[model samples]
Target chain A: MASFRSSLPVYATTLDVVWHYAFRTICGAILVFLVAPILVIIPLSFNAESFFSFTSGMVSLKPEAYSLKWYRDIFTNGMGAPEAAFGWSWLVDSWRHGQWMLALRNSVVVGVASTLVATALGTLASVGLSRPEMPFRGLIMGLLISPMIVPIIITATGLFFFFSSVGLAQTYLGLILAHALLGTPFVVITVTATLTSFDRSLMRAAANLGASPLRAFFSVQAPLILPGVISGALFAFVTSFDEVVVVLFLAEPDQRTIPRQMWSGLREQVSPTILAVATILVLISLAMLGSLEMLRRRVERLKTETPI
Target chain B: MTAVELGTEGLERRLARAERRGKLRAFLLVAPLLAFVLLSFAMPILTLVRQAAYNTLVSANLPETTALIADWKVDAPVPEPLCEALVREMHAAKEVDPAIPSRIATFVNRERAGSLSRVKQVANADIKAPYCAGLAALHDDWAQPDIWRALKIVAPSFSPRFFLQALDFRLQADGSIRSQDSNEALHLMLFRRTLLVAAGVTLACALLGFPVAYLLAHVSLRVSNMLLIIVLLPFWTSLLVRTTAWIALLQQNGVVNDTLVALHIIGEKGRLEMMYNMFATLVVMTHVLLPFMILPLFSVMKGINPNFTRAALSLGATPSTAFWKVYFPQTIPGLGAGCLLVFILAVGYYITPALVGGQSGQLISNIIAFHMQKTLNWPLAAAIGTILLAGVLLLYWLYSRLVGIDKMKLG
Candidate 1:
């Protein structure tokens, strides 16, 4: 195929090559445009000065021009005594008083709690949904996934009234349930996709071998689909971690997550600390993307290697 | 009957029972999630929609007053009995909760602004015998028939007042609806602008995403996969971070302007105001939502048999003709899916526009947030939410019809 493509017909001319180059160039530029803004913040986050733009010293590659001040400020900004000697007490003070630290704690707690709920519920539902015997599957699936399709504002407003009435508003549990609802759709989609190619006969084979249905699922299905489940959980975690709209309406001051904190920071005050946060978030996303990619490749490999 | 027939009948019955149990087991597995979603997700939205058309704020607090006012003629003077009921309810409510009268006043003021203080003044006034005269003495505006008419309109326990208001209409005392005055007709215009912006963003995504998707689809798998990661990076990035990046690049003293100034594209003093406006919203949204468009298009385009275009060209059709007739026609499903997805997402965009969208750029979502948080007007917020939800569901239905919801994928 490569040789056939290289030995083009006489009709294939320089104009075709030029058009191909132009198309590739446009695509490359668009990709750069997509990734550039994300990369732009990294250097700006490290700037010794608080400005968004690069200083001449930084452009000239002066080692003195860059500092970790903003990154340090992520922890030390709200500390009682930044000038205090580095010790456990200073760390404790930062943990207690730092805005970003509080947000980080809230984000992890909410993200993990929501991801757990979403993954459990979503995985079970996908198992049932993928079953041929499931009833009202289309309508039920649509309703289950509508959280992703519905506008966050509507969901938030609805949740605000409902949660306020139920005494869930401004509470950690309320935010957890709300984030879980939003994250479930991703879990459902990813897991469902994995199950589409899944062979059902393996379960029957295990059952014939005297394994109970639950045991069969654990031994036969779960191991094979573990990559999908983990990826789905990761997606759920990301959804909850990055979520802000619902949190804006539902969370109290103490429950503010990283994205929620960044929202207020960007809106009320534009600070280099937010850029530092953004850079950190970018790194987190990079890690997530890397893992998702690995899981996807593993799933593909598993699908091919295993037979019914 | 033979013994063999009896055994076969028993076996068939047992098999039927097992099948039923299997179905039940499957349903039971899904039931918990369905129930959780129903309580947490569906019920709240239903409550919001219901609240839009149902408010008991006035009727609940001022029950006797509301009842008495309902019997009065629209153009008639404030009846003496109605004034007595009002005074009775105010004193009674004041004893129960000090904020009740003020809450009722605020509720009434929603129908007719500036009536709260007038109502408050009456509630505060010391009254002698013949309470109507004393009420009129407390506030001169009390004697006007329109104030009384406004009270009657909002006095209903179940009212379409918020929904009407959301639609840019006012409910009159005569049980008729009329268009709101020009100054108050904000929602309809906002809804129109929201649709326009969503449509514009969809078009922009399609225009920009098509080439990239085409390149990804036609390239070697190794190259495409590498490029796909670049596209997915922003898709996975935090929305706030992306919006902040836009702010850094687009703000007056940000990188873009600085670069332009150094290159002498424009004078340093004439740095463009580019951050907070409709243009910025569109540009940034297109950037943020482009991946949504690209991914779907790429998936579909990748599935297209390249042989069709080759065959068309071999049949002596021009390359453009082959693309237009053969390749482009096949990509319509992807186009439809991508456009609908982008438009639906754009319609509900809150954070991006909130950060970058200034006055003119603001969508209906922003206004909904404003009412929910700022104005403390829950009914109006609910009403706006209901309309936005209706629009989204309609588009969603169309999308599911065009591209099955089950087929939707995320990175």
Candidate 2:
């Protein structure tokens, strides 16, 4: 692979070689540091025992030292009867009664709804922003993005007071609204990036063909920017899915999302089931990252292929 | 329709009309979100500001005394009328709700300690009008201007007392502001530590991230793309998961300690108490936020014309000089954005510190949450929030200056 050494001068001094290799070592260590913790949890989640550390048996590669009980516990921890024969009723019992399952449902409901709201609103706003005729572009953008930069604690405090007053506190609708507001900035940034780099001539061509503005957008623009919209929606979904502070402030016990559940469980006890949940969440994020990378490459390819 | 109007003026008028329509169309697209954010996000923050600024407990319950003492000098002898009104109000509040006086006392106790009993005593007593002498005889706190001044300070619906307390200062009996004693300076201390940790984290991230970002930028496209995943994976991972991972790594009997013990670097009984301290907070936070530093620097470094540095080197500059003078300055804007962004996020971070930050590791955000949740002191939390909000917004302004708001990206 081509690295710094590839670009180094032939007449490089001993000092240059030492610095180049030293830089490489530091960068390598940083990458390992960044990834090791997340990777370590994957194997730890499969540990036979409840202890957080690697056991001697597991370290010695004993096959019997690993187990799937924690993963199973994610579904059966709060189930009414785990001893019930493994039948349809047992599946139904776990699905309906499991604490983690309920949290997962809440997370998905809130994540999907908020992502939809944020993506819809943000896509429109980005469209408006991309227009040369838009007014107060900078100010509007600054305002939209302010929700992100403002401390979540402040936002949570404000919302707690305001929502309780207007009767929005502790409700799914209130949470959705809050998460939507938090997610919009991501949608706006991604969609706007896509829109600005968008080819205006195609829209002009469609308009010249007697298509209305909306028709032009649907026919000539949406396909090219669909990847951007998907990426933005993914970000919004992940944000709401992973969010904890607002959930901590706004959610009732029934409305606890995954992060909120993990928070309580963590505070109460260091259960391996939380590790199981973390590992699952990590997998979901990996999937999200994979898709986003693909979309990024597609966008890059389009930008290059389209000659100005 | 245009048959009769075919001149330059008509064409210009038509163009102006088209422009207006375009502008309106654009605004209409943005109107829904603008309204949504204004109502949901902006309004709640405004409510928080009101919470921080207004205290209704004193003004509502102690209305008569608050009004009577409105003009009373703090250092003046406790007026008999003021004392009488105060006692009457206290006794009346005792009649309506026995807890009101003590509640007021507890509320005031935050301002001046040893107040819980004083206000409770007056409320419980049968002191009558010309109650000043009797009140003073009952308790010296009644005669002193300090309690009266405390009441005066809390009397108004609008007050700076919460803000003062948040900043570790207090309004005195005579209305002069004094910084609190060291033992009372928790909020001020948290604010300082928050800033210190933020700066320290920013520096640490720059040191750790600069080289990796340089590698990503300098490497071939394929290799760089492969390495970029390492940064993006952490960025995409759930924050709590990352924090939990750190706990597992740094706990006393956890991986790092176990590895150290096995390697004989530390004895079995000497396992490090790395978790629940400033060390855990710093390491975990730096791990979580490093991607933010790397992505921006990599993006900036990738755009630099390599020839600029080569040109410097060709001009007989030493390798270090060429790198520093030519290469380093170019990365400043990126470095600035990354540092400021990390600092802003770090100052407001609650989860990592809350989970890993044992006593000494708590930041302003943690204390704010503590007040909000455990202490049930919403007004004080809101006050700390106001200060944090101001500092963050200032950084945001600088951030927006360094990189346009529209340019904020995700990997």
Interface RMSD of 2: 0.7
Q: Put down candidate 2 lDDT per residue, A33-121, tens digits, no spaces.
A: 99999999999999999988899999999999999999999989899999889999999999899999899999999999999999999
Which candidate leads the pack in TM-score? 1
User: What C-alpha lDDT, on a 0 to 100 scale, does residue A149 get in candidate 1?
Assistant: 91
Candidate 2 chain A lowest-lDDT run of ten: A1-10
Deviating ranges (above 4 Å) for candidate 2: A1-10, B1-6, B87-103, B117-145
lDDT of 1 by residue, A1-308 (tens): 33433735556667786676677788888898899999999999999998888888888999899999999999998788988998999999999999899999999999999999999999999999999988788888989989999999999999999999999999999999999999999999999899998899989999999999889999989998888899989999999999998889999888899999999998887789999999999999999999999999998898788653
Clashing pairs in 2: none
What's the i-RMS of each model? 0.8, 0.7
lDDT of 1: 0.90
- Docking tier of model 2: it is high
Worst 10 residues of 2 chain B by lDDT: B1-10
Which stretches in model 1 have alpha-carbon errors above 4 Å?
Answer: A1-10, B1-16
**lDDT agreement with native, every candidate:** 0.90, 0.90
Candidate 1, residue A268: Cα displacement in angstroms equals: 1.6
